[model samples]
Target: MYGVQINDDGTIEQMNDELAQACVNGLKNLEIHNYPQPINMEVSLLSIFCGFYGTSNETISAEGIGNIRKFNKLSANADKNYGQASSNGERKPNPWILTKILRYHNKDHYEQIIKPLLKKNYEGKKKEKQIQINQTLILNKIDLTDDFTQLDMQEKAANGEYEKEEQIVMDLTRILIYYEGETEDIYAIKGYDAICDTQVLYHKLEGTVYKQLEKININFKNKKIDEKDNSKPITVKHIFKKYASKFFKKRCKFISEDPKILTVFQGYKYKKLHTIDYECLQMYFYLIKETIAAGDERVYEYILNWIAWLIQNPGKNRELQQYYKVDKVQVKIDSLM
Candidate 1:
């Protein structure tokens, strides 16, 4: 009855229709203002065009492709984050990281934090060259011995890759200052970052615990007491299995009280969602961590089982949950996915 109310009748036609509507609505409500520049709009539109006209087919307009190239050049020239083309005529910027920074962070934030960081990175190349020049001068003056070679390596290792600590502090302080702008300002942004960091740490720890649980080889099926040698320390897997089973058993009692959860299993088989939209997963993980510390392996099992169960049920509006509206990460889940 709940499923019908939600129009999730397990019909392929309904699913396809809903998807089509979503796509149309997405295109109709498209906003280019959020991008670093209008050139990014051309890049995005080009991508969409290419996707519509498959790679094998050259049905896409050449003008659209040219626009992509034009914008890319303009974008690079406009943003100092991307360095000038090298002698080899290749773009030397870490495009992946740069794009991610541009996409998620605001223009003001980017100018304050990312711009300086990018400048520092670009300066690092100059420092490396300077170090090399210095090394060559020393080598020319000194004898060609193994000791000198060792010294050269040490000098290069010490000074070749240097970070501007002052610049870093300035960038980070910009964020703190921005948050401290409002009257009666509490450092809420740092607290938010701390919470996010905790979630990320817990997520990673939970993933490790799951992998260990899955690869568990020790048997405890019919044992009443400890059978392993006492002299040897308890293995992580052994401890994990012991506590996880305990927590699973404890959690099983809750299902009886709330029988609705049991119905979730009747709908579909468990399968990983083929989408990069995991904002809900992060939220669920945080809830699990809050309920129980992730240091305890049982908590990992609890979260993993919950995720597995959620992925199986089509009745749940999992897609809707996938998008997280946060100040730091305003991701367009549909486009990104």
Candidate 2:
């Protein structure tokens, strides 16, 4: 019999087309609600059995079917073995691999063997560079500048209204700087550096500023402090301390010249900042700012604690469920035709 495997959602995740055809041929007495129903049922049964029992017959023959039975037993055996291996977790296959294999076998020709023979039958040849230039012009016709400008304006407006906690902003910034310089993506940086950076930056900034103040006091008494010399370490310290609050406020705005820098401090609130790693808290702030800027009420939809909110309020919205339940797979299938 043909073999098939399905996900929990009843979507056909895998199938052995040849084996399915064999099952259809052998089980002709079974009702065909659709021309393909018997084969589909056989495959589903194979998948279910394999998943439950970890194995099934390597070969199958219909009852009272003599040696001249319609379907190929060898095909059924191979399919059954594959299904068994998959169900038992003895073999793992990527989805794409299975798709390509099934496609090739159903066509009754090896794709690799026939691929080179396929050729474009153009009546006339065009210059390759000319073709490339034409493609580039077509792609460049799309105008993204208006969208980008709108996003920027919205971001600036949101930043104008935002009031962020100083400590959270600093913590978020340092983490962004560290991970921004590293190979990790934004999400990875959030996971790894958020909390540690918060603690580290706060201490480092506090200590360095305090130490510089102490050194400046000692130098002033000895008349060694050069007021005009910008090169002096004390001068650097004073510059940092002088603008520290303003610098932090700018960092907290979440609409800096650097998008990455802004992203780091996105969600800094004094009350909630204490609970999460510095990175995630910052991202939360940024996301809030972005959503507000975009005029999207769905900003809270992806909040870290949203799942808890759903559990706390547990009446299902049937309209929302129906909206989600419309068969996206069937839509895709219909689109192909």
**Which candidate leads in TM-score?**
2
List runs of model 2 lying over 4 Å from the truth. Answer: 1-4, 11-337
lDDT of 2: 0.29
Q: After superposition, how far is residue 243 of candidate 2 from its true place, in Å?
A: 39
- After superposing candidate 1 on the true structure, give the runs of residues whose Cα lies further than 4 Å from its correct spot: 1-105, 138-337
Q: Write candidate 1's Cα lDDT for 267-334 as tens digits.
A: 22233457866886788667555434333445456446656666674344344323333334433333
Candidate 2 lDDT by residue in tens digits, 1-337: 0112333365534323343233223332221121112232332223222222221222332121221123323244444464343344323322222222323333333243222122111111213433443344211111211122212322433344222222222322232222222332111112213443322122123444345333321122212122224324332234334334323322322234453242323322233345657775787566543442232334333332344444454442222111111222111111111
RMSD of each: 33.4, 30.9
User: lDDT of each structure?
Assistant: 0.30, 0.29
Top-lDDT structure, candidate number: 1
Tell me each candidate's TM-score.
Answer: 0.16, 0.17
